[model samples]
Target chain A: MTDLYLQDWRAWTPHRETAGECRLDTREKPAGAAVPSMLRRRLNLLGRAVCDMLATLDSGADSIVLHASRHGDGERTLEMLYGLNDGEPLSPARFGLSVHNATVGVYSIASGNRRSQQAVAASGGEWAALMAEARGYLADGQPSVIIVFSDQPVPRRFAAYAPESSSAAVVLRLGRDPNPGARRLSETSVELELETATLQPLDIIDWLMDRRRVVACPLSRRSWQFPAVRP
Target chain B: MTTTALEHELKEMIIETLELEDVTPDDIDRDEPLFVEGLGLDSIDALELGLALQKRYGITLESEAESSRQHFANLKSLAALVESRRQK
Candidate 1:
């Protein structure tokens, strides 16, 4: 769908906070209430994914969002279980933070865009669901939804049931067209291999980046070489 | 286990388990507080440490348990709990 003017893209990792960088007083997330370390790892990873999207996007996008971890805050779920056993003495803040929408909520809060569209997909084909929603939102042929795909590794608690890969988050700005010099959703990922098995998007990027070629490899899978984008 | 070894082991576990990044195993003092002064661990760290203890030692400390405070009070205290749990 990204037919024209979509070419520019950039990527980056946040500079590690130096001791001096840590001097900037960071506000407490979940405020005065503490979330588990794993949950905080999710929060931090969310920030990284969003930043990557913002930094690399063609800049033609007016609205954006992130889709992350199919598990959708498993650590929070774990905490909820813990809270129940701990006399049901749940922390209101932590409890509030456990909602599935909280991932997008944090982004909305950070960007000061109450109107920004964000969603989480518990599985691969959910992108089509978002695209379907976009069609309704953009019936006028105007761009609307910028879908992002980010996922974190599943926690050990659910390892047996809905096993997950390592921690990861991915952001994509889905729309009609990106910016000038931007690469359109060229070739329209004609036939995707949505593994009934979970796929980690970031892993795909890393593999492509490593091979400097878009190996047909699904992000999480290793054995199969689908097709490299180019040499 | 004697008190010194217990403290030594506690410090080792905290440093290794948390990936404290800024602190080394040797930096932690046995008598130093675990929550604030020494490692600056927050409640989440407590949960993580609890999980680690359970995984490694097969022992758990409930939040409401009276002995939990005494067990988690400091490195020395935690070591004592670990030693006793091991004995049992």
Candidate 2:
């Protein structure tokens, strides 16, 4: 089990009317105010949500960034596929921003952050991978690591092959040192094993907002426990 | 010398293709640079604009040709290129 301090967090969802302390205006898309107009134009809804959530958190310039997504920019990929099938030349902008790391790359560029950035797209257990990555960074003596998890529902073409999911994003700043105002987060392995399971962004948001003690993920056979908010 | 209908249309196309929300047809100076200085566009925008031109006008640029860079240098050059080369 590894214990880490949750220095700060912000979450967003298109379906939910409220996400903990952040109340998103459902009528309009997230403006991504922190990102400049030039770069912001490249982001889709999910990317914009991630940027908006990150803007609310104290993401330091030197902190390392770890971004995980189950379905990274499926719409853009689908568009390119259609163009290819029709023998139409692909849009260079779409092709350039189609990579899994493109969202975080845009964020890094907009924020002028030269720190280390890692993008993960695990088949499952992406949340666990993110937590493990954050823990590893903390153990390596990094002051703080910014962990972002964002995913959107697969495009219509891939809906049959994928499970149903809503668009959501969660950004957390994890640190080794505990702060009195921060929440305490720890990971524990559970004996119950499942064949395929992954913690969703909504799971983390629910755990953080509600008075829940344990959020379990059978996919990874691990559980994250929010022991208490430090006083 | 003046902004022609095609130039106006090209400006609108540039704004729409790049999603330059803050810019309009009137904002694009025909003789000014479209990249790296006046409009502050970068390589990605250049590629995007090239794709847009290809789709709309069947215009294809040789990536290594010096003339292609000159054609993309300003809106006036782009308009001139389109007037002489546009297929559609």
| CA displacement after TM-score superposition, residue B58 of candidate 2 (Å) | 1.9
Candidates' TM-scores?
0.48, 0.93
Backbone-clash count (model 1): 18
Candidate 2: C-alpha lDDT = 0.81
Q: Which lDDT values do the candidates have, in the order given? A: 0.52, 0.81
- What would the per-residue lDDT of candidate 2 be over residues A1-231, giving only the tens digit for each residue? 346888888777766657436444342477777788888888887787777666556446566889998888888899899889999888888888899999888888887778899999887678888988998988888878899988888898889988777788888899877876677877787876675446778777777777456777666788887765443
Count of backbone clashes, every candidate in sequence: 18, 0
Residue A196 of model 1: what lDDT? Answer: 41
Q: Is the docking of candidate 2 incorrect, acceptable, medium or high quality?
A: medium
State the DockQ of every prediction.
0.04, 0.77
Model 1 per-residue lDDT tens digits across residues A122-224:
4554434444455455564656455554455566777787655554444444455555433333223334364544345554445323433332323323232
Candidate 1 off by > 4 Å: A1-42, A48-68, A130-140, A186-196, A203-231, B1-88
Clashing pairs in 2: none
Runs in model 2 lying further than 4 Å from the true structure = A23-28, A193-197, A228-231, B1-3
